[model samples]
Target: MGAVTPPDGFTFDGLVAKLAAHLRARGSLTDARWEEALRAVPRHLFAPAAAWFTSNHASAPRGRFALDDEPAAWWTAVYADTSVVLQTDDGAGDPLSGKGLFSSSVSAPGIVFPFLELLAPQKGDRILEIGTGSGWTAALLSWAAGANSVISIEVDPEMAARAAANLRKAGSAAQLVVGDGVKGWPEQAPFDRVHVTVGVSDIPMAWIEQTRPGGVIVLPWHAGGLVGHQLRLKVVNETTAVGRFHGTASYMMLREQRYNTRWSGHHHEAAHRSTTRISPRTFWDMDLGAQLLCIALVPRVSWYDVSEDGGDSLLLYELDDHAAEGSWAACDLKAGAAEAEVTQYGDRRLWDELSSAYRQWISLGRPGYDRFGLTVDPAGIQLWLDHPSARTWKMQT
Candidate 1:
């Protein structure tokens, strides 16, 4: 990859224009309004003076780039279509130390634009945005819809304060509320749209109740795993909302909705051990939609980890519902091995269920994200393949 040149004069406006042009050239800024919004709201104003660059395996940030120390690098990062980490370890650890999980961030333009495109905001539309990280998305929403028509909620007070300052700096008048987003903001009910920036384990009923009957809700939905799917649900009536997966992406889970109980390093004596011809790659190499199908087929099973034993041998763990009394399963595979060893403990056979789900997915012609849809109603959430009338899997209540 070649280095991104700082715009002539290295001015903020120059950088903004350059970024907008880049996004347009890359086909991410296809919508004229969204392109204009990108031009209007400068990302640098919302990004922290000192921000961290993150990678997939990075537990913590490798280091921080201070604008004062490296203006060119900082400007390039802020303008680049990539996510910049703002906080780590739930805002408890040193980001420069390179040793914590990312808590908050300015999502990359690549992911952000698809969401805005799917949202398809219109003039005079009232929008409610969840997860006001860095206030960039809120500012974008304000630009898409009039500033007075958008309300953004954040859970962290400090983050909220920073977002408020950023919004003010960007001259955005969008409302910023510091509160849990799971409840949705009812004071401004019947909103035409609801956009959740954070990943949610379940579709909150509050969001459904607060939206107008015909309103749309766009969010990164993940049951209990790493990868998340983008869902664009339309409120059909007071009790139901249905939609199909528009795309695949991942985001940090909402703080209040995070799962606390997790599998620890322990092997149960009652674990049933067996060998199967199924390669571990069946689950490992699945696309985002297939991974999600595994979750839907076996609700409450979460992908744990994959470990290598200093050689070609690999171990994969899948944990059952956190509250399921430590139920878990592990599969051992070796290079060039024809069969993989599988072990299951606790009340549920997670591996068996996963294998069955994989076979079922194959029978369905290995559908993509667009082939699946979700229905939320009074009873519970249902995952359907092809159409709602097709085979459906009921999620745990």
Candidate 2:
């Protein structure tokens, strides 16, 4: 056969625009800034290899292939509008450096957009961000919030420097500091908003101290027993704020604080061999709902570990605490059948409480995230849902 020509001619720009429009159509992108960021920021420059990836493992564990390894594949994957794991548990992918497992990645646009809307920073408002893995999110924040208003702290120096350079190339001149992001940059304290791209087992109280009262601080809150929840704190006072799980996303555990002993302490020796039948989707949905319920019941951790056996599996949420909590398989996938058996372990009977709370919420008409209003009182915080029932949790005064 004659030399194969490239499939038609799909320029990277065209592909990027197509993907951006796709997201826009879904209402995933609410602002015009998405296209602008897509056009302005150099995704190829940041991820030249551009691997093809998909989160769904319902079929099989078939993903994580590098495009650079195959030119045609890379060209297509570069513009797919999906999260691609750049580095794994091993390390960066320089054959010379050896292919490390994908522990970190550029989060999907779906996840990033919500937080962007939630933060809602005007161009002039100063913003601080923690965890600059791919720098893509920071670029978006800089574009919408203004580079001068954006000051991001990245714990991984290598990733931080790369992100800084990428930001510069994107024309976003935000201050990129190479340091531990958990500390919350003292110089940039009192920021209008602080968003963390990575997950954490514990709330870095410093984040609260640094953010201006009434400011928003968004991060993945991880607790032991494998439950991760999103937190959006609106500072009521210097010492405390009230917030709830906005949504869910996954991130590799931070280097120093990977486990909190509460999660990994009690491992099901036969976990890999556990026999349970559950429709993949139903099992996952219940597990997903269970995850959020647990977040509401036992808010902790900032990472995820998803698994499946035939059609049955568990969605294990984790905290920095050694305890890893997981939602039980509620379905036997062999047939369309579900049995709600939420397991509770650790010092915390985490899953049981979560499942029970979910039933209670259902009894109470199942209020959405908007129903949860965070009110700051002099002593601590009061999470008022539906304006009638309120849960009071203390914040350091």
Candidate 3:
């Protein structure tokens, strides 16, 4: 086969320079070393020949753009500050034909640089990276901390093979392993840094065991809910890792740690009917910290909103696959209304729990995500306000 042609009037050096400038202007690509790496590595090399571009509003990719067919569009996407999906539904569906959940992707540069800034790996630091994705992150890590010092793990064999090939083509010698990320590569135990590209509900003890004391493990953490926060934890000891939320970012959940919920979808026969002084907009307009607090306080609840001629309302469902019992709550919130009507069913009153958590969040001065921190150990994780010892809530496994 002959070599593929680059986009007309496109140069690698010029594209990299533009991408670097874009990231720097956004305040994400602050580190000089990371910027240099971004300029050096070619993102298109790691992306698939045909990839899907994602946006905030769309459920699946808007559509797939092929390199050979739409070279200019493909080149633009590669350099854009948005995520490009590589695989969909675990490679089960045809991404080019239909819509499906993104399985793996080259993350947006905006989030990628923030993660690298939080990681702050040194020259010779040993790093273990989870969810290798398109190998772009591994290549960047190698460029920053030496290719020989990085070991990246991917659960899917196909993704692993592709990532390895991409790394080799980029001349990066970062070691790529095909295995479960949750088990964490114990063979390379006591790494100075561990970076997880996927979102996790729980902090695995294996990760703590594999990280050296005082080492940093940066991961996107959520409490079994839709929204997630970036956690930057430092291994305090063999059994403990403590850190605070730096910011919020949505990531593909770790395959092993993905949560599946069974909803009964019965909302008419609620046992209790009441009204709340809280407006429907309270939850709808909640900040990241308050949103996370709701998940922390009321575990295993999935929330959504419905629009109708009567009014806009929020629904909360208790997700228990084994029980499959009808436990749900709804709040009918009308515009300009002083109060909202709430109805609860089954054993758990989800709306009441959410309201209580929201009140507590307000009582705490409505702290942002940066004020909340987590401590993980064999005893389970603790979500605290302000500091580690201050008022804390024990997280459900």
Best by TM-score: 3
Each candidate structure's TM-score, on Cα atoms with residue i matched to residue i, is 0.89, 0.71, 0.92
Local distance difference test scores for all models: 0.77, 0.58, 0.81
Query: Judged by lDDT, which candidate is best?
Result: 3
List candidate 2 segments past 4 Å from native: 1-8, 50-69, 90-101, 222-231, 255-257, 260-284, 287-293, 296-355, 362-365, 373-384, 387-389, 392-397
Candidate 1 similarity to native, TM-score: 0.89
Model 3 backbone overlap count: 0
Give the C-alpha lDDT of model 1: 0.77
Ten residues in a row with the worst lDDT in model 3? Answer: 54-63
Provide C-alpha RMSD values for all models, in order. Answer: 4.1, 6.5, 2.7
What is the TM-score of candidate 2?
Answer: 0.71
lDDT of 3 at 286: 74
- Model 2's alpha-carbon lDDT is 0.58
* Residue lDDT tens for model 2, 196-229: 8776655667788888888998876544334445
lDDT of 1 at 111: 79
What does candidate 1 score in Cα RMSD to the true structure?
Answer: 4.1
lDDT of 3 by residue, 1-397 (tens): 0124466788777777877887787787887877778767778878788877765332323456778777777776677776888788899976565477678989988888899999999889999999999899998888889759999999999989989989988889899999988899999788999999998887889998999999999998866544678889999998999998887778988876665443455646646999987766567657878877777898878776676776778887765644556578888877667788998898889889988988988998888877788899999988888889998998875
Model 2 error, position 63 (Å): 4.0
